[model samples]
Target: MTSALPDVARHEASDIALALDWVGMRGIAIPLVLGGPEAAPAAATAELAVDLPDPHAKGIHMSRLYRLLGAFAQHGKLSPGSLQRLLREMMESHTDCGSRAARIGLEFHLLQQRPALRTPGLAGWKSYPVSVQAMHRDGITQVELAVRIQYSSTCPCSAALSRQAVRNAFAEHFGDAPGITRGDALDWISGHASLATPHSQRSEAEIRIRLSPAADTLPLLAMIDCAEMALATPVQTAVKRADEQAFAQLNGANLMYVEDAARRLRQALEQHFGACSVAVSHHESLHPHDAVASCATPGWKRMG
Candidate 1:
């Protein structure tokens, strides 16, 4: 025997996020694929996120998102098309529930390679943290990409002070060498300058950019190279004695302040992404606080 029950029943619904703008899960770890240095694909761990609108909807079907992600993991290629498709699926999941908008965030560690300084072989596995965020509303989608690169920055002030100290020592010790040859003078200067103290700073550049829909490809590794060049010194993975010496010389040659680091990144972004907005932050070792700067697309307000 079957009991008579209505298919639909009236129930009270509560607005949980009346005062809040967004609420969701974060740092959810999952396996993902990213474009390799040579356009091949590599596996990485991805942190995923989704925004929930109505708190009283009981809870989001988290399993559905996971299954959708599995589909990408199984067969999707790591490219602009795949990324956009993932975003589209996430938005559709939310839109089916009568929500107006949805947001998804993914973070992964990408691998790259570097040629050995003294050897002919290539070394692998320089990991960089990358993030991608997608927001959808009313048939429009916006995607943002972020990458963090590790590099070295020598202190300009400290280098200048070291030079001054060396110059003073030379004037005091070698005042009698008036007829010294240029090479001999250089040797004398190097002997005295070797005693000066050099300050080395460990720094990181964090860059965020809005992607062009037409140029859907994500140039994360290229962007990383731009940041490394801007800072003038990037930490190396595989190093020989020569490489170490060269790296030391690089630090000595290109000393910079945190402001200089930010400006360098800004210039690089402007050169690479002409119409894209860029936000750069330099984490400095010499200071207690991080230095940050931002440059926007010329007509961001108009676009908004």
Candidate 2:
């Protein structure tokens, strides 16, 4: 039985956007399976984006992207290989629409274990939000990964001031008692000064790279570890008295301003990802501002 409705014509494009470089959706949410550093797969909420390179085109077929995501949701693992496949799928979808380039951004929360300082067996999961981005053009692909870690930083200037305050306090309290032990002087100093101001800065480490199609899928855990080590003090989940003391000692040893944090991350990324570009941002507490630093290799020059 034929219906009376007329057939709609298929939309076609000859010349799409000659003026615009990129156009697409952002903040699309989807479920994802992330693998690595776990006995089983971890479920994560992914914020995904795909670049559609034209305005003259009728519209992006958004359903295709969702279908690709669904295929991955069923059995896909989040590894370098899986990510490459996902990018290829996205590019293929866009190619059907005549796009010469494709880009994708995905954000997810990753979990890692935190070992107790003194207790060897006590450990728990800690969450770190991460992002991965990929771009394809003319058979070339580039990838970037980013992670956010929380850490404590003591202001060196503040630490020095606090030290002087303590010395003065000992002099005033003990009345020039030369017999006072160094430990006793430190105790008196801490009592007189703001011994520890919480310098909780949400820090970020981002690395972008141009990769060979055969390049190994990055070890996400390795990247996370490098960033944490660069920052020096990551917040812990299962902490005891010993852990707290260790954390305090770390803070004291690694006194950093926002600039120092960014530089350290940049150096660490350079050491770890030699062919990649790196950027670090430290959300500062002392001011209503953020401190950011970036370094890039020749391979990742386009990132700037």
Candidate 3:
């Protein structure tokens, strides 16, 4: 008979005797099916990992995990039902290897068709950054979904200051003529009031929410709607003069600071989703650095 192959993985001892919390793979190429069978799945990358609780076990079945993931990605639809099954299978595959936990992260872009403001035509596609993570550990199964929303943010303080400047300019222009004609005053203010405008910049809201036990599917579009509705300044698609005016009016009506943006998103998520974390960042045109704010609700469980 031929010489037996040396199974070092099962027979060899480690130089150090210690247990690791997690070990496996990250940034693996995987296609994600973010919807039901009716919707086509999208390509995505994943970080699949498991715990090494047994210090003596040479290694877990890495190939088994990969094959299982391959099957899941190929046939299974990516929703609450499919993700829970995938995580359980992963944990079961490593049961004999002394792994008590397993985790996977899928990152991908979800294309959304946005409607033009005050127009019958539809806007082009807008891709929102979306990530879903599932972890089965110590008998606790948790699933989380994260989405990034982009919009415009106008500075509340800057808006007030600009209004004050306009008032001063109007006072100076009419100081000599208290009895200035209504037409003359209206024309003067029309040209001068807009002279000092507040600075606004692009902003983003990143929200992560854990699914409730009752949830059967990931409410991706609903989550986006909640965030955009609360902020009331989502970036538009197709541009028209009327749409531009509407956008300007929105910014003016919803002047806020970075902290305000964070709280608005957090409050909306808290009221609707219940368990969530939100972070908002304003890329300031007035300053070189960006402004940021964040909050987490009580139901949120921090994941690694």
lDDT of each: 0.65, 0.66, 0.85
TM-score of candidate 3 on Cα atoms, chains taken together: 0.93
Per-residue lDDT tens digits for candidate 2, residues 175-293, read 95677788986776566655434454555556554434444454577777787887778777788889889978888889887678767776777787766656666677777987777
Question: Superposing all C-alpha atoms, what RMSD in Å does each candidate have to the true structure?
Answer: 4.5, 4.2, 2.3
Q: In angstroms, how far off is 224's CA in candidate 2?
A: 1.1
Q: Name the better of 1 and 2 by lDDT.
A: 2
Q: Per-candidate TM vs. native?
A: 0.79, 0.77, 0.93
Per-residue lDDT of model 3, residues 57-84, tens digit only:
7776677789988998888778876777
* Model 3 C-alpha lDDT versus the unseen true structure: 0.85
Spell out the clash pairs found in candidate 2: 166-189
* Per-structure clash totals for the candidates: 0, 1, 0
In model 2, the runs with Cα more than 4 Å from the true position are: 1-9, 12-25, 35-56, 93-96, 174-216, 275-304
